[model samples]
Target: MHVRTWADRINNLREINTLRNQIFVGFTLTMILVLVFAGAFIYGEVSVLLKQSAEKHIQQTAIQANGRLDVLLKQIDSLTTQVVTDSYVQKLLLKEAKGMPSNFNERQSLLQIANNYMAYSSGISSLELYTLDNRRLFPLDDSSIKRISMNALTQADEKKGRIAWVGIDPRVSDSVLAIRRINLLDNSYLPGGYLVVHVYREYFNMYESETEKEEKNPFRSRELMLLSDSEGNPIISDLDDEAAKSVLAQTGSTVTLEQESMLAVRQQSKVADWKLVLLMPVEAATEGISVLRTAIFVSIGIAALAFLLLTLPLSTMITRPIQQLMRSMRRARFGGLRVIPDGRNYFRTLEINELNNTYNQMVTHMNELIQVVYEKEITQSRTELKALQAQINPHFLFNTLEAFYWSLEEKEESELAQTILAMSGLFRYVIGSAADNDERVTIRDELEHAQRYLQIMKMRLIDRLHWFIEADEQLLQVPIPKLIIQPLVENAILHGVESRISPGSVTIRVFSAKPGFATIAVIDDGVGMDGEALNKLMQSIEGVPSQEPKKGAGVAMSNVQRRLKLYYPNTNERGSGLQIDSKAGAGTTVSFDITIPPEGDGLS
Candidate 1:
C-alpha cells in the first residue's frame, strides 16, 4: 500500500539518518521476511499434510462404497441372466404381446421367477417385461420416469443399451433407480421384448446413513455426498442444493466457500462414474492451527520489539553527538566565526570535548597573532618614512645649486637650470604629501612629477629627445598609485630612445577612459624588444613564471607594475592596471588605469 518509486525512496533515504536506519531497516526487513517465509512454509506444509490425510480417508471410504455399488449392479445383471435362462420367462418375452388382449398366466409365471431374486434383494424396485410392438397398460407398479405410461414404454424402447444408474426419480421419494434391459433375441438375434430392474435408492444410501456406524469419523460425520453419471445428466447430491452444485462446479479437488467458510473436497468413484464430495467447516478443521499461529506471531513480535528497543539506545549514542557537532558548526557558518564556549558542557564524550577545546584554542591564538602582526606593520612603516625623509634633503641641495646656475646666460645653460628647478619641485611634491603610508596621489601630482622628470631628460638629450603630454583636463585630479607613471617615462628614455639611432619621442597621455576610471599611457618610438626578450620582460611585469634579473634592461617597469597591482588589484575581469604592448622594430606603449573617485575622495 505504501507505493513509492525507487527514486522517491532514494530521496527519502538521503533525507534520513542513512547509516543507522540502513542497518535497522536491513536487519528488520531481513528478520520479517525470514519469519514470514518460515511461517508460511510451515502453514502450507501442515495444511497439505492434514488435507492429504483427510482426503485419503475419504478416498478409502468412497472406494469401499463404490465397490459395493459395482457389486450390487453386477448381481442385478446376474439376476437378469437368471431370468433370461428361465424357460417360462423366455416364452413370455419372446411371444409377441402386441395383438393379445392379455396373457395373464404367462406374465404371472415370468414375475414368479423374478420374484425369487426380488424378495431376497432389497435394492431391486421391480422387474417387468415389455414387447417392442405395443404401448399398453399392464399391472406395473409406479416409479420414476413413467413406468406405467405408454409414452414412457415407447421412450424406454429408444434406450438400446443396458445397466444405467438413475438419480432423483420423480416417480419415487428421492430414490435412485437402475434400469437393466435384457435382450430377448430370437434365432435371428433381434429384440422380441425387454426386461427392466429398478434398484432402490436405499441400497446406495445405506452406508451413508447415520445408523450405519457407531464411531464418529471426521471426514464423514458431516454431510457426505455421492453422485453417479447416468445417461447425460450430471452427478446428484443431497446436501445444501446450491452449495452442492457450486462445489460440483469447482475445478479443484478442494474448495473453501467464503460465506460459511466450509471446506469441500471432491473425490472420484473408482468403481462407478460418480463423484464423492465431503463438506466440513473451516473453523472445525483448523481450530488448533489458529492457536498455534497466534503463539508464533506473538513470539516473533516480542523478538522484534526487543530488537528495536535495544537499537534505540545504540543509534542515539552514535547519532546524537554527531548531530551536536554539526549544530555547532552550522551556527559558526551562518551565525559568526564563533567557537564552542564550554567544551565539556557541549559534548558528552571526552575525546569529542577535547577536539572542540583544541579548535577553540586555535581560534584564540590566531586572533592574538593577528593583533601582533598589525602592530609590527605600523612600526615598519614609520621606520621607512624616516629613512625616506633622510634621502630628500640631499636631493634638494642639488636643486638649489641649479637655481644659482640659473643666473648664467647661455640659453642652453638656463634650460638646464629650469630642469633642476623642476626636479626640486618634484622632490618637494613627493616629500610633503599627506602621509608616508598614503601611496595614493592625484592624477595632477603624478603628471607633474613625470613632466619634471621629462624636463630633466630633455637637457641630457636636448636635440635627440622629443616629448609631449596629452590629458583629459577633467581627470587631472583623480587619485592614483604614487610615482606610477614617472617610472614608465624613465624606462622609455633609458631602454628605448637612448639605444635607438633615430631621435625618439616619449608621449604621456592621461585621460578619463570610462566612468569612474582614468587611464595613463606612455608611448615611445624606440628600439622595441625581440620576441624572446619581450616575453622575459612581460613575465617580470606580470609576476608570473620567473622574473628577469633586476639588472641591465630590467629598468623601472617592475616597480611600476608592483605598485599598480597593489592599488588596482584585478579582483574581477575589469582588469589589470598595467598593459604592455610592443613588437620588435615598432614601438612600446605601457598603459595603466587608476580609480577616478569624487573630487573630495581618493583611492581606498
Candidate 2:
C-alpha cells in the first residue's frame, strides 16, 4: 500500500512544471525510499534473530526434559535390580521353582517389604512378581495386576537380569513399566522368575507441570513435549495423538501446527530407547516484533513529514528570486527601459542577486545610451558640414603652389620652380592618403615623397645638412606605409643635424635585407646622444613616459613606431620594426624592415 502511494505521488510530481515543485517532490521521494529500505532491513534481521533465539530456547528445554526422563528410568531400573536380588524373594522364587509350598507368614512379610519399597519411591505405582511358568507370585490380589507382553519377556530374558524398558504396560491404564528376569545362583544357572515395575503416567506429566510453572504467563509460548518409543509410537505427549504423529514426522527445526509457525527441537533419552520432541510456536516466541514494526513505521512517517515541511520552504526560497527576475524582465520588455528594483539587502543567493544587479545595470546603461545617441547624431551632422566646407583647402593650396612654380619657371629660376613643384606634390600626397584612409603605398612612391620632403628641408638648412638616397631598383615596387620613411628622415634632420655646429650628412638606404624582406635606413652623422639621452629617447618612442619629456624627434619617432606596428602587427622578423642605434658624437641610424607578400596572397 505504501509503495503504491509513493509511485502515484512520483507520477503526479512529473506533471508539475515549476522548479520548486520538482525539487520538493524529488527530495521527498529520495528520503522516503531510504527510510523504507532501512526499516525493512532492520525488521528482517530482527525477525531472524528472534527465531534463532526461540530455537535455542526450545532445544534447551528438550534436552532438560530428556535428562529428567533418563534419571527417572534409571531409578526404575535400580528398583527392579534391588527386588530381583532380595534374599527373601530369591529363596521364595527357588522354592516356587521346586514346586514347594510357602507359609502364609513368609508371603505376608514379602508383601510388606514390597509395599514399603513402592510407598517410599517417587512416581512408582506398583511392583509385580511372576514365576517362570507365568504364575503371579508376590501380588496375592490379581485384580490390578497388568499382564506384560511376551516380546517384553523375551527382551528381558536376553538381558540376563538387566532391566528392559517397555514404553507402556499394555493391560494397565496410564502406567509405564519396566521388566527384569531373576537368574538362580546355582550350577544350572537359569531364569527363576520375572519382575515388572509399574510407574504412573504422572512421571512424564510432572516435567510438563514444572515447565508451565516456570513460564507462568499464559500469553507466552507454550512448549509441547512428546516422548516416543523405539518404534516411533508416542508413549507420553502434551499434544493429541494426530498432532504428535505429525510433529514426529517433521525433520526441520521449524514446523507449522494448527495454522501457527512452530520451532521444533528433538532429544534422545540415555536410559531408555526413546526420543523427546519439543514444539514452540514462532508467533508467541517473537510476540514483540509487531510493536517494533509499528514504532519503525511511525518514526519513518514523522521523519518524512518533517522533511516535506522543510523542503517546500527551501525550494520556494531557491526559486523565488528567479521567478521575480522573470516577472521583472516581462515588465521591462513591454514598458521600455526601466531599472529593476535593487535586492542586494534581501537574504538571497549570490548568483541570483548578481543577475538582478546585472539586469538593473543593463537598464541604466540603455537609458544613458538613448541620450548619448541623440547628442552623437547632432554632433555628427555638424562635423559632416564642416568636413564639406574644408574639402577645398588642400586643392586651393596645391593650385596656388602650381601657379607659383609656373611663375618661377617663366622667370628662368628653375631650381626655385622645382622646389615649389616638389612642395606641391608633397602636400597632395599627404592629404590624398589621409582622405582615403589607406596607408599602404609602393616603396617607389614612398621614396619619392621622402625625397620631396628632404628637398624642402635642404632649402631651409642649406650647407648645415647634406643628404643622399641609395636604392635597389627591383625592391622599389614593394609596399610599405606611406609616411614611414619620411618620419625617420624628419627625426634625423631635426634631432641630429639641427643641433650640430658643423655640416651633417644624412643617407637614406633602401634595399633587400633578405629574399622576402626589405630594409629602409636613415643614417645621419650628427651630434649623437650619450647613453642616458639615448635610453630616454628609446623609451619615449616605445610610448613609455620619461622623467624629462623630449619633443620634436621623440614625437615623430613614436608616431612612426606606432604606424609600423599597426601595418605589420604579426611580423616576427628581428629588425621588422623601427630600430635606432646611436653613439656619442659618432652617428645615429634609424631603420625598419618590410615583409614582402607572396605572389597571389593578400597583405595582412
Candidate 3:
C-alpha cells in the first residue's frame, strides 16, 4: 500500500464529480489563504508597531537624561561661579598673581570659601584653585596639590572668566568638571587663578535613581545608558567595553552588540557638551510580540476549525436533497415511476425545489403516457386477434359445411337441424365478439361459445371425437379474456386429437385452485409433441416471432397468450401468460390462471 500525499488526495477530491466535494475544496483553500494572509498581515503590523514603540521609548529616555544632566550642570555652574567671583577669594588670587607667596591665613581663607561652596552643593565633590603657571593655589599643601592640565587652562583662559563645562576629567576620572578663570578686579583684565570643580558621577546616579523610582520607568533593567564626551569617549556608561564601543560607533539611531539589534537614542547635553545615549535591545523592547504571534496562530486555527464546521452543514444543505433526487431519478430510469411528495416544500433552494417539482411532474406525465400506451397496445392485440380470426373465416366455413354434410348422411332430419343450428350459433358468437370493444367476458359465456364450436366438431368427428368441460359454479362468473378458452380447445383439437387414429378426448377445465385465483385448462389425450416443438411453441406464444411462420397451434396460442397478458398485466400465477405441458406420444395441456378482482371492480 502506498501512502497518499496531500497533492494526490486533493487530486482525488477534484476527480470526485460531486457538488459537495467541489464546494469543500474551494472553500477550504480560500479559507486557508485568508487565514495565512491575515496572520501575516497582523504579524507584520504588530512588528512595526513594536519597533516604533521601542524607538519612541528609547528617544524619550535619552531626552529625559539630557534634561536632568543639564539641570545638574547649571546648579554646579552657579555654585562654582560664586566661589570664583567672591571678593576675598579674588583678593587671595590677586596676591598669588602679584608674585606674593600666599600665607597660611590667606590659604585658610580660600579653603574656607571652597568648603562653603562644597557644603552648599552635594554634586560638587571637590574644588581646586590653580595659578596661571598651573600651580595649585588654594589648599596649598604640595602633597595635596592637583595641577590642572594646559588643555583645561587654555580652554578656561579663552572663555575669559566664563565657565567651560567638560566631560570626565582625565586626572580625576570619577568626576566631570566645570572650569572658569577668575580675572583681576582691574581695568586691564588678566587671569588671576583657575577654578576647577569636580562633580562626582554620584550626581548622575542620583538623577537616574529618581527616574527608576517612577511607575513607568523608561530606563528599565534591560537597558544600557551611556554619557560620552564630545570626542565619543564614554565618561559614564552601564555597558561593558565592547558594548560601549558599539554604542559610540553609531552612525544612526540604532546599534547592534552581540548579534542582537538595539534601539540607540543619543542626545547632546546643552550645558556639558556630552552625548547621552540610551540602548534598548530589540528582544526586550518587543517582548510582547512573541505572545502576539502565538495569539495570531491560535486565532487562525480556531477560525479554520469554525469554517470547517460550517462547511459541512453548508455543503450538506445543498447536496443532500440533490443526492436524494439522483437516487429517485435512477429508480425512474429503471421503470420504477414515482413522484417526490411535497418536493417543493422539502428543499431550501428555489431552483432545486423547482427541479424537484419538474421531476415529479415528468414522472406523473410519463405514468399517464404509459397507461395510455398500455391500453392502446392491449386494444391493438385484441384487434389483431380478431383480424386473425377473420382470416380463418373461410377455413371455419369449409369445416362447418363439411360437418353439415356428415350430419345429413349419419343422422335423421332432427339431428341435421341440430347441427345447422349449432353452426349458426357458433357463427353468431364469433361475429358478435369480433365487433365488441370489451375484450373480457364471464367464464360461463366463453364456455358456451366454445361448446358451440365443439358441437360442430362432434358432428364432424362422430365416434372419434370426445369432449368434456368441468367448470366450477363459483368460477363460472369470473371475467377472463374473450376467446381465451376457445383457442386452447381449438389448438387441442387441431394438434392433439385430429391426427390420432384412436378416438381422443379434449377436456376443458375451469376451477378455482386457490383463493382469489381461477385456473382454466384444455387438455387432450392424442398425438403430442416433443421438447423441441414444445419449446418453439412456448417461445412463439411469448412474442418471439418465428423465422418461418406456419399454420400451427403456436399462432392461436400466441394470440390467446397476448390477450391474457394485456388483460391481466399484473398476473403471475406460477409465471405470466400460459403454461403448456406435453411429452412425445403422451398428451398436451395448455392452461393459465387469473386473479379474481373484487366485486364491482372493472379491471379494464
- Residue-wise C-alpha lDDT for candidate 3, range 380-488, written one tens digit per residue: 9889987886675544775676677567767667677777877766766666534554667788989998998888898889988899999989788888777788888
Alpha-carbon deviation at 201 in model 1, angstroms: 3.3
Cα lDDT tens digits for candidate 1, 133-189: 533212342223334445434434555534444444546654554444446555354
RMSD of each: 13.4, 12.6, 25.2
Which 10-residue window of candidate 1 scores lowest in summed lDDT? 135-144
- TM-scores of the models, in the order given: 0.43, 0.54, 0.55
Give the deviation of candidate 3 from the true structure as CA RMSD. Answer: 25.2
The alpha-carbon lDDT assigned to residue 319 of candidate 2 equals 89
lDDT of 1 at 27: 72
Task: Show where candidate 2 strays beyond 4 Å.
Answer: 1-15, 90-107, 141-147, 158-160, 183-192, 208-221, 330-340, 344-347, 350-604
Q: Which candidate would rank higher by lDDT, 1 or 3?
A: 3
By lDDT, who's the top model here? 2
Candidate 3 contains a number of clashing pairs equal to: 0
* lDDT of every model, 2 decimals: 0.66, 0.81, 0.79
